[model samples]
Target: MTDRTDETDDTHRPGDQPEQHRVTDGGVTAAPGREGAIPEEDTNVTEVFPEGNLDLRAGADNCYKCTTCDTSCPVAEVDEEFPGPKFQGPEQWRLKRKEDADIDGSIMSCSNCMRCDSACPSDVPLSQMHNEARGEYVDDQMDALSTEYVRNRILSNYRTSAELASKVPQLANFAMNFGPARWVMEKVLGVTKEREFPEFAEQTFREWWRERGGAHVQSSEKRIAYFHGCYSNYNTPEVAKAMVRVFEHFGYEILVPPQKCSGTPMFANGMLDDARRDAETNVENLASAIADGADVIASCTSCSLSLRQEYPELFDIDGVEDVSDNTFEAVEYLRIYEDLEGELADAELDGQSFGYHGPCHARNQGLHRQAVELFRDVDGVRVEDVGDSCSGISGTYGWKEEKYDTSMKIGEEMFEHMKHAEGEAGMTECPTCAMQMEHGTGYDIYHPLELLEDALVD
Candidate 1:
């Protein structure tokens, strides 16, 4: 089995000379020694701020020091050492652009959750500024071989790690569970031993789909392309299966198109160049599917957000807008494009109650109520909105050794909410949120589709 921590030559120095990088297929690529580095000129800040003449500083000027972003930040509420998004985002962004100032190291604490964006009255693009600043900081300040660098690289490339481990899942699980191995990982990779690693599935979703001859299904007029993301593909195929089963029962033909990770991990870990690559690849593939008369849907809220929002905001790529326009959160797609509420009206939940935790990404996309509304008219089924609280595990953010305490601290309210919620189980559209909630509270948490699948009548 490949060692998860073994460093490959994937580091990219985007701060290097522009001559060392070349534009290929609408993305910047670095020279041999600095592979995957995107040039500074190709940063693509214009996509988000078309009125700013391609300058991110214009957005920063909108902030009037309101502190709404500061108050909305979950990390600021928990970690005093970390400054709020107002400081890390717009405040520093102005200085960084005008004076060429270094990004405050606190920028890493922003978590890309977009709560600040949602809260800002002035509509400042705080998260986008922080993301760009993080990439700049990493390229300028971080040593390529340092512990932080290597650890983040490993975490950001989770798709590769998961793929390799899934090939030999028993051995991988044993190694993960083994105390000594975890100690070594803690010492070397800086992954906290306090939290258990998410185990790889014995069979990947793609593999299972292929084996079941799902790829051979006949095409239908109402066709959809599925982007299962890495979590559903590797850690929990059941989520993807439930989505597939539910969609198939609704008379839609599903296409599991080729896809990379949605790049949320990379964006969080300051691996923007790799993220750009993923965005490019996914946009190209999904766009082709869209052209062939299929709308894209993702069960993971983060994945859907990436497809529908992040790709267009972060990259100046072709067909991204079209891809974004067609992409939908699985539940949101069903609620909008299908008669989901009517179909589920006759479906029975048999006195089941669930606490629905709207994930940050889902709320960012403004589709947080889709899942709750689906069960509104169903008899004997009560789904409560347990408040919009950050789960503190922003994708891989909670798994790092240094952030574990802050992560738990930020999550305490959410954990408390679930413990006292009027349900035997909880439902969320985010995989990491589900993981963090289960770890924080003892209750089982599931994707909303999983419960809906069980409740669907023949």
Candidate 2:
């Protein structure tokens, strides 16, 4: 919000004498040689305020009170208490510039689904401003360490929890399903009792790769580095395996690089600092893989979005742009770089029908139609675009106790569409969307990679 843009003093000539001396924030007095001259050390203010680079505050000025974003927001339509993106994003962002501005409690209600970003006609980065504001609000409340804060912290770093739970997955799964444990989580941690937790796999994808001699496979000319995010690594290793199988069939050597969580949950929960750390780690590792003659890809749409878009937009880290340029979603990578349609032309699906619920992040990335088109190209496969509605489970948003009802409410339209749609099952690229779809409608949801993997011939 600070006016970091450099201003030019057009009134003074290049050889004009100094009129007055001014002291800068860095405690350096500028000896006026030219009108616009300032201390060289004060040029980069980001060193003093690292958070300056994380926010798109300047974009807030572009909002012209158009209600396009408001109408498109799924949360705003469902929750009246929540102000739409017009007020919550650019309008609130302007107010946040003041030191004494009161932070709206409703900002926490934002699902961060990013429909506002796509709907804005003025190219305003509405969601980015909201995300930064949420971080400010969370930091302000950290001293109290409220139950909601504690719950957010727990959910934000779900990678750690998943890793620990995966060690003894059966017991972990049992504890989650146990009624008394659920009550304890509900009462103490603010997790909702209505939603069932995702089950951890007995073995992780990395462990399976090592055990099955996948790590020793000879490198092919076409290589891809897989960024199997937390969900695919822990809860649904089968999806990761399906990706591996399909990629190998295309004669591409798979490289599983050392990576961390995609930081989608951290961003959604207003843990910008945590998300920055994740971006730094992932960019370093994925950039290294790219430097080694491999392209980066993720099966999870959120993970791909984090690597390909969020990191560059929210962080000023080295190699972030390079990593972003090279990263692609799994099906997207295949479609762009390989002959996916031609390769799958002969493959048969036996007339399977699927209702495709495009994830919000995928829509934000503008690649939602890629999967739909690819699936439609397959013989005897029916794919339906089951409306562009938010699943309301924006990562960890729906899991919180206070948000459970709101989350379900926001998802009602999508759930209704899925219930009536003629399909063998629901198909999507997001793990959390799959979970929410299954929860809302008593139907099985699967990643498109799993279906494509089964349909492809060896």
Candidate 3:
């Protein structure tokens, strides 16, 4: 096993280059040491702004320093280095405009759970600011071609990795579990040895959809385009099947459109440019579905958040606004259509129970307990709200070597709750949360849709 310590790389700063420091993206300056000081005119820089040219200063003006965001932060609960969302968000926003405001390294610890955005009585987009600040911080600390940069770039492209892994799952899983392979990853890629990797499905959801006569399937006017995310499509195709069955059972035509990763991983990892590009692509792809009278739906809360919220808030994209209006979280969509609950009421779960782990992002969307409520409607099914808790696996954050321990620590309470719950299985909207729950508690986890599908009375 690798020797682990609580040490952080904060102290490793290059020699002072005050003259060379130049503010680039209105956030942070470049890294400390370089060959020669590059002039601003010589650099081909284009700062990507959010749609509506979102005024960060205007949003920052809403802060009254109530400490509400700080108190509500899940990351701050685990890591003290993170001074809380208030500091990283509005407070920093106010500070950054000052003539002499240093880049706060502590903001890097934020998982971007977005709980602070909900916690704010003033409704400050604190988490959004922190996310942008993180991108800037990453830009300031590392060069584009640095080892960490390359590693992050690869990790951010999880869809590509998943595609390859799904093609040869056994070999991929073996490579991940093998000691020497893990050692190489820890040493070279900065992924931790102890972290359990999610297994890839033998067949992708898209492949399964095609085999099941997806193109031939016809239905009523009610239609939905499923955004299965990377996990449901590649890691857990069964969830995708369950979602389709449940949707079809409720009398909706399911459209499985060609989709890409929602760029949550890229945003979380500070790859803003790539994330923006992904947002642009996804929004454009979703357009045809939206135009065909199909509302876009996603089972994964993070993916839904990206499609319905993040793209509009964090990236300048044309179709994002339209997509946001038409997009829905799977359960949230079902919750709105009360007749679906009536259909679920007839489903026989036979005393089946689930300890529902409401993901932070799902809660951030304000549809709290939608999954639990959906499960509760089934006959003989007992659903316990395991309390709103951060699963600590904020996309790729928990996969990194340095952040692994903190991730596990943040998840300890939720894991303990699952361990003691009456349910035999765990339920959650976010796939990464499911991965963390299964790893932490050694219990089989299911997407709420899977439970719903299983409960369906033929």
Which prediction has the highest TM-score against the true structure?
Answer: 2
Q: 1 or 3, which is superior by lDDT?
A: 1
Candidate 2 overall Cα lDDT vs. reference?
0.83
Shift in Å, residue 431, candidate 3:
0.4
Q: Could you tell me every candidate's TM-score relative to the true structure?
A: 0.86, 0.87, 0.85
Query: In model 3, where do residues sit more than 4 Å from their true spots?
Result: 1-54, 100-102
Q: List runs of model 1 lying over 4 Å from the truth.
A: 1-54, 215-220
Query: Tens digit of lDDT per residue, candidate 3, span 1-458?
Result: 01112233332332333555644443367765666766645768443332223357646766888998888877788787778888888777667665356668877678888888778776677767877887876777767786677777888999988888888999998887888888899899888888777877788889988888893447657889899898888889998888888877778888888778898888777878878877777888898889988899999989988887778777767777889889998878877874667777667866877788988988878776887767765678888887777889887888888889999998998988887888778888888888898889888888888877887625
Q: In candidate 1, what are the lDDT values of residues 313-356, reduced to their tens digit?
A: 67888999899889988888888877887888788778988888
Give the per-residue Cα lDDT of candidate 2 at 248.
80
Find the 10 residues in a row with the least total lDDT in model 3: 1-10
RMSD of each candidate relative to the true structure: 12.7, 6.6, 12.1
Pairs that collide, model 2 = none
Sequence-dependent TM-score of model 2:
0.87
Best by lDDT: 2
